[model samples]
Target: QVTLLQTVVGAHDLFDVTVQLQPGGGIFQTFVRGSGDDFSVVVPDVTRVNKYGRSADCTSNNEIRPLCYCKSNLMPTSSPSSASKSTK
Candidate 1:
């Protein structure tokens, strides 16, 4: 199971976010709602890239799930010699 860092939300428990992929590839903007135990929005799961983002506004009923943005690895740089320390 995933372990949360344990945080408290204000009376309105939701936050908006805008994530940019490595090398400024693309931006992922969304407002995840709820504690992530059980929350969802309209999405197609039969295929890949199956996830939805926030609704038109905060008052909308269709709220996406809450998730903590993180980084597990580094993206490649334009430099051919750009290298990272081995994780092994």
Candidate 2:
């Protein structure tokens, strides 16, 4: 099953979306924009690395790094309020 992961609307009404296939699937990233009255995939489907447990696989050179959600990002972070509530 293919799931729509993320969608970003850019200038000129362009839609940048990332779709992920279920069951050990790769990330398919593409861009869509309006063609007259109908919308279409303007760009080709680019398969990005599965950065689930291996965020290290994505480097600075990777153009899709900005669009990826690293597993580390899902980790809970200490909120400002929690950090401020320290023992006296």
Q: Count the backbone clashes (under 3 Å) in each candidate.
A: 0, 0
The residue-level lDDT of candidate 2 at 87 comes to 42
TM-score (C-alpha) between model 1 and the true structure: 0.26
Please provide, for model 2 over 1-88, each residue's C-alpha lDDT reduced to its tens digit, 9 standing for 90 to 100.
Answer: 3455334644666766667754335566777776469988877656564554454344564666534555554568998888888744
Work out how many backbone clashes candidate 1 has: 0
Q: lDDT: which candidate is best? A: 2
User: Given candidate 1, what's the lDDT at residue 2?
Assistant: 18
Clashing pairs in 1: none
TM-score of each: 0.26, 0.37
lDDT of 1 by residue, 1-88 (tens): 1112222357255544445443223345444455658643223221112233331223334333222122322433454444333432
Count: clashes, candidate 2: 0
Candidate 2 clashes between residue pairs 3 or more apart in a chain or in different chains: none
Candidate 2 global CA lDDT score: 0.60
Ten residues in a row with the worst lDDT in model 2?
1-10
Best by TM-score: 2
